[model samples]
Target: MSETVPNTTAPGRRSGGRVHRLALAGTLATVLGVSLVNGVTPAGAAEAPLSQSGKATASSSERGDLSAAAAIDGKENTRWSSAFSDPQWLQVDLGASKAIKKIVLKWENAYATAFTIQTSSGGGQWKTIHTTTAGKGGVQTLNVSATGRYVRLNTTRRSSQYGVSLWEFEVYGTGSGTATPRPSATPTTTPTTIPTKPAPTTATPPASGTNLPKGPVPPGAVRVAEFLAECPYTHRLPDDPIVMPGLSGGSHMHSFFGNTSTNADSDIKSLLKGGTTCSPKADLSSYWVPTLYSDDKPVEPTGTTFYYLGEGIKDELMAQTRPLPLGLRIVAGNAKATGVNDPTSSSRWSCLHAGEVGSSKNFVNCPAGKMLESYLDFPHCWNGKDLDSPDHKSHMSYPVNGACPASHPVIVPKLRQVLRYPVSGDPARFRLSSGPGYTMHADFFNAWPEAEMERRVRDCIRPIVKCGAGGTP
Candidate 1:
C-alpha cells in the first residue's frame, strides 16, 4: 500500500525547429523595437500561433480566476472553464488582422457539442468560417483560409454536465502587416456582446466558503454548520504519505501544513507526536498539496489551508457527521486530471476576492494584488467495514441527494479544504508541481485527539452552528 511510484507524465508539448526560430526571430525583433512582416510566415516556414499572445476573453467564465486566458496559454494542463450555458463564446485578437491558415481546438471532457468558428476583420460583426452541429470533444484540427484580426469559438450546446472547456485554442497562420502582438485585455466580467450564463450547476465543483456569512445563530441564517482548523504553511517536501508512502522524495514537491514532521513514512502515531501550525493546538492532522511554482521557483503558500467540516451534505446529515477517524487518510481532487472536465477531478480554482475574476478547473489569471485559491470537498460517506480501501478512496463516497451511498452508509464530516496561493497577474507564469491548477489535489492524515475531534463534530457541526478554532461559538 505504500511503495508505489505514481505516474507523472505530462501531455506532449508542441515544438519544432522552424517554430522555435520563428518565435526567436519575433522576440529579437520586439527587443530591437522593430516589426516582422506583419505576421506573415516566411516562405516554406510552418505557421505559428497568431492569437497575439494575450489573455483571452470569453462571453462568460465559471468564476473569477478561471479567466479565458487559460485556453490560449499553450499548456495542456491548463484550460478555460466556462459557466454552464448555451451560446457561450471565446475569442482572441491577433493584434491586427492576419492570414488565418488553421485553427486547432483542444477540448476537455466538457466540450462543445455544436459551435461556429467566427472571424472578424475590422468590423464589429463576426463572420463565420466554420460551423458544426455534431462536434466531438477532444482534439480537432480545422483547415481554413481567412483574413481577420479576431477569431472566436461560439459554442451553442454542451455534451457534458459542465460548460464547454478547452485546453488549447490555437490560431495558426502568418501576420499580415507590421502590427506588433499585444496582450489581450483581461476582463473580470463577461463580454457585453453576449448574455451572461446562469449560476453554475451542482455538477461544478463547489467553490470556497470565504464569503460565507457568520451568524451567531439567527433564524433563517445560512446554515453553514462547520468547525475549522486553519493550518498555516509548515514545510515543503517531495514526499506523500498517502500516495508514495515510505518512499521519501518519490513524489512531486508539496507544501505541507499542520503537523510539521510529516514525511513519506509518517503515520498517525508519528503525526500525533509532531508539532503543528494549526490554530487549534489539539489538531496534528497533516495536510498537503502539490507545491505551486512561479517562474520556475517554488512558492510557498502565504495563506493557510482551512479544514472545514459539515460543508457539502445536507444540514440534517450534520448529526451523522462523525469526526475523521485517526490515521484515516483521504485524498480530495485528482492530481492526474488531463483537463477541465476530468470526471475524477474535484478541484476548482478561483480568485481570492469576491467576484474579482472568473473561476475554472484549470489555472486562472487572477488580477494583480489578488491571490489564486482552490477548493475541494472530501468524500463524506464511509464504509464501516474498512478504515481505508485498496484504492485509498473506495471506502469513502460523496452523498447522493443528501443521503450517503448504501455501499458506504456511515456519514462522516464532509471535510472541505480551501487553499490559497500568493500569485497574481499572468496565469501562464504559474504551474503546480503536479501539472496545472486543475490537477491540484490535497491529502489529509487525521491525527487529532479523538476526544477533541468528537466534541467539535458533536457540538459545533451536529447542531448546525459555526464554531471557531476553540470549537465554540
Candidate 2:
C-alpha cells in the first residue's frame, strides 16, 4: 500500500486528500487545484500489470518542494495544486512490460468536460487512449489499452478554460501477457433476405396508441440505398428463409428483450408502427420489433445489427441535439457461420449503425475535452484455455441461420494483438453452468476477425451443438 501525504501547497500546487478543493468567481465557475508528486517506486514482478493482483508500495524518496507539476510519484496518480485554475492534470506510470487494458479514474466534486486519458510506454511516446467527460462526486471507470510506463490525465478546466476539476485517480491493467490472436474460419456467400420466415397472415387491427412516426424519414436518417452501399452485409438479406419460421425470438435468431419471446404481436407491431412505404415493395419498420412489410425493396434485404447500430450512430444520434448516422463499423473475414457446414470459409458484414446520426463526433460532450475510453471499453469473454490447441472445440458464430453452422472452428495467423479483459458485472461476458455440466464461459463460443475490430460479435458454441447443449439443431 502507498502512504498518503498531508495537504501541503508549494506556490502553484496543492496536495492532501484525493479530491480537489475549488473556488468559484461570480457565476463563472473556475476550478483552482494542483498537486506536485515526487519519489518513484517500481512493481517488482512480471505478472499482468493491472490485474486485481498488482500491489502498490510506498516510495523511499522524501517529499520535495512540491511546486513542480512535472514531479511524479511513479504510481497511479499525481498531486496537483488548487490555487491556479479550474482543472488540473497529472499522469500515471504502468511500468515496463505491461499493456493497459482498462483504467478506473477517481473524481473529486467538480464538473469536468474536456479531459483526455493518455498513455505512454516509456513516459515519452504518448498516445490518446481515450477521451471522456469526468463524472463528479465519485469514480468514473475508463477502459483503454496502450503500451506505456506512464499514464496521464490531461485536463482543461482552469480559470479561463471549460473543463472539469479533477481530484484523485486509480488505474488498472493486465500487465504484460500474451494477447489472443484471432482464428480464421470459412466464409459463405451472402443471403438474399432476412432469415426466419414469418407465420401465416393473421394481420391484427391497425396498431393504435403507438403514435410512431410514419414515412417522412427522420431528420438524419440515411437513405435505404445509401445504407445498403455502406453496409456490405445488406447483400445477404434477400428472401432469407430463416425469417419464415419465426422461432421463439431467442438471442440473435430474432430479437428479444431478455430471455422470453412471446407472440404478443408486440414485436412485429412495433416494427411497422411508425414506418412508411419506401417504394411499392419497400415498406420499412421503426419500432422495437423488426419487420419489413414490403416485397421488393431496392436495397438489399438484411436483418438489423442492433447492438452495432445502436453503438455506432443510431443510439448516439437519438440521444443528442443534431441527428445523423455517424459511427459505423464493418468486418470481413474467414469463419464458419452458424447453420453453415463448411468450416473452411469466411464471410463479411456491416455490424454497426443502422439508425440516425448526430453532429457530435463522440457519444457525449464534456466541459473538459471528452474522455474517449468509456465507449471503447468493450465487454469480452475470457476462457482460461487457449484456442490454439488442436483438441479445442470451436464456438458458435453469431446471427445464426440455416446456411451456417451453430458453431465452427477456424484458424488465423497472428498479426496485431489486442487482449480483451473480462469483468465480473458484465452479463454479456460471464460463465454459466448446466445442472450437471461444467461451467461454460462465453469465450468458449466464438471470436471476431483479426483484421476488423469494429465487428465485435463472435459466437461461442460447441463443435457438436445439440438441442439442449446450448444450441438448437
Best by lDDT: 1
Clashes of 2: 92
Candidate lDDT values, in order: 0.65, 0.24
Where is model 2 more than 4 Å wrong at Cα? Answer: 1-83, 133-137, 158-167, 176-473
Q: Per-prediction TM-score, please? A: 0.55, 0.23
lDDT of 1 by residue, 1-473 (tens): 00000001121122124433444564465456553544444454444476525325688766422446556655555456678778799987665788898887877667788999999975688889999999976667788899888899999999865667776788877764432222222111101111122221111222322232222343211123556777889889999887777889888999999999999999778998999999898999999999989999988766564645554355444556666677677777777777887766666776664232556788788767677777666777777555555456766777666667778776667676766677887889989999988888888888889888878777666665545678774
- Displacement of residue 285 (Cα, Å) in model 1 is 0.2
- The TM-score of predicted model 2 comes to 0.23
For all candidates, the clash counts are: 13, 92
For candidate 2, write residues 1-473 as lDDT tens digits.
Answer: 00111111121222224333321120022112211112112333322123222111111111111111213222223332232344455554333446676564434333345577777655267789887653343345565656665666676553222223233345555455322111212122322221222332221222223232212222211111011001111111111112222333332221111112122232333333322322111222111112111122222122211111111112111111111111101111221223223332221111111101111111221112111110111111111123212212121122212122313211111111011111112122221111100110111111111212111111101110001111111
Q: Which ten residues in a row have the lowest lDDT in candidate 1?
A: 1-10
Model 2 poorest 10 in a row by lDDT: 223-232
